[model samples]
Target: MKPDKSRSGCPDPSTNALQWGIKVKSSNFLVIESDASRAQAIVSALSFLGYRPVLADRVDADETGEQWRGAFVGTVEDEAQLEQFLASLGRNARNLPMLVAADSPVATSLIADDARSQLIELIDLPLRYERLAEAMRSLQTRVEPIAASRRFVGQSGPMQRVNALIRQVAPFDSSVLVLGESGSGKELVARTIHDCSPRRDKPFVAINCGAIPAELLESELFGHEKGAFTGAISTRKGRFEMAEGGTLFLDEIGDMSLPMQVKLLRVLQERVFERVGGNRAQRCDVRIIAATHRNLEEFIERGSFREDLFYRLSVFPLEMPSLRQRLEDLPALIGEFNQRLVQRGLSRVRFAPSAMNALRQHGWPGNVRELSNLVERMAILMPHGEVRGMDLPEKYRGALPIEEVTGAALIAMMEEQPMIADSFAYGEGDPSVLPLEGLDLKDHLAGIEIGLIRQALNSANGVVAHAAKLLRVQRTTLVEKLRKYGLSETVQAG
Candidate 1:
C-alpha cells in the first residue's frame, strides 16, 4: 500500500487520534521514515527548528553518507529489518545518540532488545520533538572536547601539564604571565590560551616590548592622535585598541622600561587609557598575556622593574619547559618537522638510533628553535637520507681530548737536556745557540697561554667552571679568554 503523503500529526498508539506537536530546526539529523506522512511532518518540524534533516525511505537506504551528530529513525517494521539497519550503521549506530519513533509497542520492545539500543531514545507512536531536541543538545556538548584535543601535538608529561593549565585558565579573563627560556615556545602557549578562551572570535594582537624603542613604546601601546609627535601625521590605533575584546600578548615584557611599566600599571588598574595627545580616555576590554625569558624577580630586586605591575601581570603564571627537559618528545618533534619539510617540497630525512642518542645528549641552550634549525639544516644537507651519529656536527657528536705541555713534563724534558754550562765552558762559547730567525717573545708567550687554556678546558671535559677551577681563575675570566681566542666553539664541541 502507498503511504500517505500529506503531513499529519503523529497518531497516538492508544487513542488513534492526532496530537499536538512541537517543531525543531537545523540540528543536522539523519532521519529514516517508513511512513510518508510521518516523514513529511518530521522534516517540516525539524526545518522550522533550524535543523537540516535528511529523509530516508529505510534506515539502510540513507544516501547522505555524511556523519550526523544526531539521528531520528521512525516506524521500524519488524525486528529483522531493525537489526539489518543497525548492522548497516555499524559502529556509528552504537556510539551516536539516536531518537527512534516506533509505530507499535512490539516494535519498540524489539528495538530495545538490541545491544546498540543503549544510546537510543525510544518514543512510541506519537513523536516527542521536545525530547529529541534535548538529546541533541546534550550530544553536542560531549563532542566538543574531542575536537579541542586535536590542536596540540605532544604527549610528554610537561606538555600534558601545559595542556591541563591551558584548559583550566582559558575560561577566565585574568592576566597571564608566561615564563620560559628563549625559543622555548612561550608564544605558542599564549596563542593556545587565546584560541580556547571566550574571546576566541575576536582578534589577537602581539607586540614585542623589547623590539620597540623605549621612546615610542607608549604611543604603540596607547595609540597616538593626529599631530601627537613628529611622525604622528594621522590618528593610529595601538595594540590595545586593535585587540579590544580579544587578547594582547606582550612578548618580552621584562624589557619594558620603568616608565612604560607605570603607564601599563595604570591601564591595568583602571581598565582605561588615553591617546598620546588626546584627553579622552578610551576603555579597554583586552585580556593581557605577557611572556618573557628574563628573570623579572631579579629585575625588581635591581629596581629596574615594578613589583606591583609584576603582581598584576602574573595573576596566573605559566612556565614553558625547555626542550631539554622534554627530551622524550624528541622523536615526535622530529617527525613533525620532517612532515613540514615534506609539505614544503623537500625530501624527508630520518635519524638513526645513534644520531637520536647524540642529539639527546647535547645541551640545547636555544631549545626548540635550535632543534628546528638543525633539522632544517640536516634536511638540506642530506635529503631523504638516514642521519647517523657521525653526520651530526662535531659539537653534537662528542667531546675531544685537550692536549697540553704541563710544567712537570717541561721540567723533565729540561733535565734530560745536557748541562748547558758544560757545553758552554763559562763565557768562552755562546751561552745558548740563537736561532737564525728572530722570534717574537710576546707571540711565544701568548701561544703558550692559549695552549695551556685549551688543555685546561679539555682536561675539565669542556666545562667552563671546572676549567676555571683547574686554572685558578674565575669562570668569567676564562670565558672572556675563550672568546678572545675564538675557542668557544671548541668548548661547545666537547
Candidate 2:
C-alpha cells in the first residue's frame, strides 16, 4: 500500500521514526507541532533517537509538567497560538527549554524575539541527528536537576507548603535550617534544595556534627594541614572545602558542642576559616543547609547551643511534617517504596483499603523512614500480593492517637467479651466473608460492639446498668466503653 502524503507532498510522517535506529542518550520531549502530519514527523524524529516525544494533542488531555523534559515547536503556528501554548504550561514549567524546527527564515521570523532567548535553538528542520542530539544534551542538563526533586514526593498540603518554601529560597544563596523529628527526611529536604538550586551541578557534601568527636569536627569542617594531628599524615579537605561552590549540609547541628558552635558562628560571619594548625585562612563560598531533630531554642536557653549560630543557620526554616500528620500521602509513599523494591529484584506488594486504614491509624513516630521500612518488609513477606488488614504486622494493624491497640489486643478483647461476640452483627450475612477491599479488624470489631451497645441501651430504656445486664457485661465495663467512644454523656449508672 502507498503511504499517506501531506498537501506539501511529504511522505507519511508516521513511518519516518524507523528511518533512524533508536539510541539511549536522548530525552523525553514534547512535540509541540499543531499540524497532524507535522506532529507525527516530530514524534518519528524523537523516537528514532531514543527520545520519548509527546504530541501536542496529548498536552490538551493531560497538562502535567513533570512528564515533559522540553518541547519541539513548529514556527508555522501563529504568534497568538504559540503564546497561548506557552501560557498553558503555567509558572512551574515556565523555564522549560524549547526548540523550534523551522523550514525557512519566514517561519523563524514568526516567533517572538523575547521567546527566542527561551529556546535552545531555532535549527533548520529535516531533523538531522547530530544537531538534534546536541540540542537534547543541552535540554537534559537542565531537566536532570529538575527531575531530582521529583523524588521528594508528596501532594499533601503540608508537603505543598514545604515545596513552596524550597522554590522560594533555592535560587538565592541563603542558609536553611530544617527542623523535624528524627527520621523525618531532613537530609532529603536539604538535598532537594541543592538539586533545585543554581549550584545543582556542583557537589552536595553532607556531614553529621553529632556523629564526629568534638576534637575532630573542627578539622572535618575546616580541613587540616599535613601532620596537624597524629592521624593527619597528609593534608585533607573538609566538607566546606569539598563543597566549595555548592551546598554543605550540616546534619544534627544542635548537637555541636558550645566551643564548636562558636567556631562555626565565626565562619558564618566571616565566610573564612583556617585549616587546623595552619594560620592561612581559606575562603568559604558554599551555602549552608543545616538540620536537627533537637530544638535549638531550648539548647540556647540551656546555654548548650550558641544563640548567634541558631540565627545564622535559620535564614529560611523548613519543618518536615511527620508521616502520621500527612496520612493522605501514605499510599503514594508506599507505592514509591514498592517500586524501589521492584528495582531491587523483589516483586511488588499492594495494600488493601482496609489494610491502608490500619496503616494510617499508626502514630508513625519514626515518620517516613519507618513507613519505607514497613513497605520493604511487606514486599519481602508477601511478594506480588495484596495485603489485607490481618496480613499486616501486629504493630501496624491498629493504633489511634487517643488509644493504642493491636490485632492481638483486638482478638483478646473479642475473646473476653464472649456475650458481646455472640450478639455481634445479629447474624448479618456471612461473618467470614471479606469485602473487596478487606476489613480493618479493630474498626470492624469496634463498629459491631458499638452497634450492640446502642441496641442494648435502647432496649433497656437508656439505663447503663440495665443495658449492661442485657449485654451480659459488668456495668463499669459498659460505662467505660461508652465514655471511650464518646457515645453518650448522660445516662444513669443504675
Candidate 3:
C-alpha cells in the first residue's frame, strides 16, 4: 500500500503548478484508494500541488456534487463498486477527467469498455505525480470552450440559419419540433439544443416512437409498475422519469399511434402522467424536443395525427436542410469522414475533382446518412488510394455522348490551320461544322480522347475493364491508351 521509493523521483508539485501558471487554492480532487498509506501519499502530492484532496473509499454522486474538479481511482478491484460509483455521478460527470491506477487485466478491460471512462487519463499502476500533473493540465485545456456552434459541421447558408435558430431557442424550455429527412441529424440537433440549454447538467434521454410497438409504446413513455402487464416483472421508470429535469427527445413522433399521441398530449398539457397500474401521478419537469421525417400536417389531414398535438409540439419549429440543399458542405463533411476513418485504422482517401463534381450533382434522397454510407463504402473499397471519377457508382455518372473522330481526320484539320478551340462549341446547336481560321487537330483530338476516357472511366467508377467496355475497346487497348495519355494514374482496376 506504501509508495515504492525505488521508483519515485518525488518532484516538487508546486514547481509543476507554477510552470502551468495554475492558481490552484481550493480546487478539489477526489482520491479513491482503499489503501490508507497510498491514499495519504496521493493526498500529500495533491496538497503540495496547491489542490485540496478529498480522500474517500468510494465515489458518492450526491456528496461530491460539482465541488470536485477531477478524480483519481486507485486499483479498482470491484466492478460493481466502480459501476455504482460512476452511475451516481450521472450524465453530467461522464466527461469528468479521471486517472485510474490498475495492474490487473480485469480492471483495465473493465475501465476500457465502460462508457464512464471516456476521459480516462491513464491506467498505469503505482501512480506517479508527474503523470498526474500531465492529466490535470490536459483536462484543464478541455474545460475551455471554443464555441457551441463548432460542435456541428457545415457553414452553408441553410446550416448557418439553423445554427442561429438553435442559439436563439436553446436558452428557453419551450417545446421544439425538429423537421428533417431520415438521416438528416435530427437527434444531433436535439442534443445540441439540450447541451446549450440550462438543463445540460441533467440527463438527456431519447426514444424512437416509431421503433417501439404500439402495445408497448405507452409503457415505454410512462413507467410501468410491477405486474402492470404480463411481462412487467418490476417497477420500471420510463424515458420521462429518466429525463427528469433535462430533455426528452421523441424521435419519429409522427409514428406514434392515436392512443399514444393522446396520452402524450395530456402529458404536455397537464405536465403530469401516471405509471401503468399506478394511481400516483408524476410531474413532468423535462423539456420536450420531438423530431420526425413525416409531415405531421399531412398526417393531420389524413386524420392520423392530432391537430392539437401538432400545435403543442410546434411551438418552436426547426427545419433541417437536406444534403442536396447544402452541397457546399460536402468537402468539409468528406474531410471529417476521412479523419474519422483514419481514427478507425482505415486509410484516409480523397476524391478526384470529377468525382467530387459527380457527388455534388447527386440527388441525396437519404440525406447525410446516404452520403456517410457512400463515404464508408469508398473507404473500404479503396482503402489506400484516391477516389477518381471512375470510382463513383454507375448511377451517379451522367450520360456522355460517344464522339466518333478519327486521329487522321483530327491531324488533317489541325494541319490545315491552328484551331481556336475556345471559339467553337462542340456538339451544340449546329450539326454542320463551322468555318474556322485556325485548328490544332492533334491537341483537339487528344483533349477529346482524354475527355471521353475520363467520362467512360467515371461511368465505370475506376474499373478499367468496365471503362474499356464502355469505350467499346479491348482492356489492353484501353490500358495502352491510358498509359499513352498519362491517364492510367486516374484509374483503378477492379
Candidate 4:
C-alpha cells in the first residue's frame, strides 16, 4: 500500500503504522488503546493484514460519509478512561461490536448495566493473530443487532408481538404498563422502551415498590426534606426527580398500598408532586413505566388498587409471555445468557441434546429469570464444558430415563410399569392377535406408547401436567417417555 498523503500531498509517516485523522471505512477498525506498545502491535497486525488502522480522534464517520465496521478498545487504565473512550465514539457508534484487549475485570466494568446488548469480545494479554482474526470475523458477521433484538432476545410469536408493541409505544410519551409473572422480564421490556425512545440519553431509574417498606415507599418516590423523618438526615431527590427528562420505572406497582396508590395517582393526574414535609409542589417531567406481576384489575375489585391509577399506568398494557408460553425460545434465551456469562469472565457451556430436551419438559414457573439462573449455575458447575442430561439439577432431570439417571436421581424418579395398562392394537377375538409370524412384543408396545403420548400431549395444549392427567400417569413418567420417543415441545406445539 502507498503512503497516505496529507491534504498538502506530503507523505505522512505518522499514518504508516497507526492511522490518525483519516476517515474510517467499513474495512477499518477504530483503535482506542491506552497502552502504546500494545496499540502499535495491534495496529501493525491490522495494517499487515490489509486493514486500515483508524484512530479514535478522527472526525465522526458520519461527517466524512464513512461507515464503521467495529472498534478495538485497548487495556483500560481505569473505569474513567473506559467511560471516556466509549463516550468519545459518539452515539452513532453504539452498535459497533468492540474487541477489547483487556482482562476480564475490565470487560465486566465496561458491560455493567448496559441495556442495549452491545456485542463485545475479550482478548487476553500477549494477543495472538488467530484470536484477533476470530474476533474480527465475528464482528464482521454481526455488524447489525442479533436476530432482530438489541435488548430482548427471542423469535417466537409472543416475543415478536412484544417487540412490536415496544416499538409502537416507544416513540410516544404514553405510560406503559408491563404485566407478567415475576421474573418474566418485565423490567427488560420497560428498559427497552426507554432505550428506544427520545429520552434514551437521559436517566432510567427503577425501584421495586414491593421490596421497599410501605412507610418508606412514599419517601422513596418523592424526595423528603432534611427533617422529614427520623432517618431523613438530609434532603434527597426521589426517583421521579432523578428521572427527570427521562423514564422512571416503577416495578411491582400493584404491590403499592392503597394510600401510596392514592398519592401516586394524584401525581399521575396532576403531573406534579412535592417532597415529603415540603409545602412547595414540584413539576414532574419524567415519563412513567410501571410493571407488576399481580393483576391490578383484581386488586382494584378488592379495593387494594385504585381504578384511576390503573388507567393512568395501563395506557399501553404489554403482557410479557412466560417462558412456558414460548418454550420454543429456550435455545435463543440460553444463547443470550451464555453471551452475558462470557462477558462476566465465565466460560461458556452448551447443553447436550438430551439435556436441552429435559429443559423443555420443565414447567418454568419462574420464567426467564429462572432460566438465566440455571444457565449461570450450569456454567459455573461445568465451566467450558457441555452439560449432559445427568448434569442438570434433580428437578430438571427428574424425568430422565433410568438409563440416563444416576443412583441418586432414582430418589426423584419412580419406575413402575403397572401405573398404566399397555394395551395393544390387536382385537381380542382376531386370529391376527396370535400371529403365526409373531411380531416383536417390545416394538409393538412402544408404538402404542408413542401414539398414546402424542394424543395426550395434543389434548393438553403441550402442558405436561395436563397431559399426565389425561394419560393417568405420573408427570415424570410422561416426560421420560417424551424423551424416549423424541416428542419435544415442537411436536407437542404442533
lDDT of 2 at 34: 56
Best by lDDT: 4
Candidate 1 structure, TM-score to reference:
0.52
lDDT of 1 by residue, 1-494 (tens): 74443344433223321112223222246666667677667665555455556553333333324455666677655433443444444334334556666554234543433222444566654546786566556555444432332255568999899999999999999999999999888877887898799887566667889988999999878888889999776676677886777789999999999999999999999999999999999999999999999999999999999999999999999999998899998988888767666655677778877788789999999988788789889999999678877677777865311112233333343346334322322233443355367443433444455656867877888988889889999888888777655567777532
lDDT of 4 by residue, 188-287 (tens): 8987898899987666767889878999889878988889889766666677876677789999898899899999989998989999999999998899
Error in Å for residue 180 of model 4? 0.6
In model 3, the runs with Cα more than 4 Å from the true position are 1-57, 60-150, 399-494
Which residue pairs of candidate 2 clash?
none
The pairs that clash in candidate 1 are: 24-49, 25-49, 25-50, 25-51, 26-50, 26-51, 27-51
Worst 10 residues of 2 by lDDT: 18-27
lDDT digits (tens) for residues 325-425 of candidate 2: 88999878877776666555677888887788898788899998898888878888998778877678888877432233333454466568664455453
For each candidate, C-alpha RMSD in Å?
A: 22.0, 17.6, 10.8, 13.2
CA shift at 309, candidate 3, in angstroms? Answer: 0.6
Model 1 Cα displacement at 217 (Å)?
0.9
Name model 1 segments beyond 4 Å from true: 1-151, 399-494
TM-scores vs. true structure, each candidate: 0.52, 0.56, 0.62, 0.57
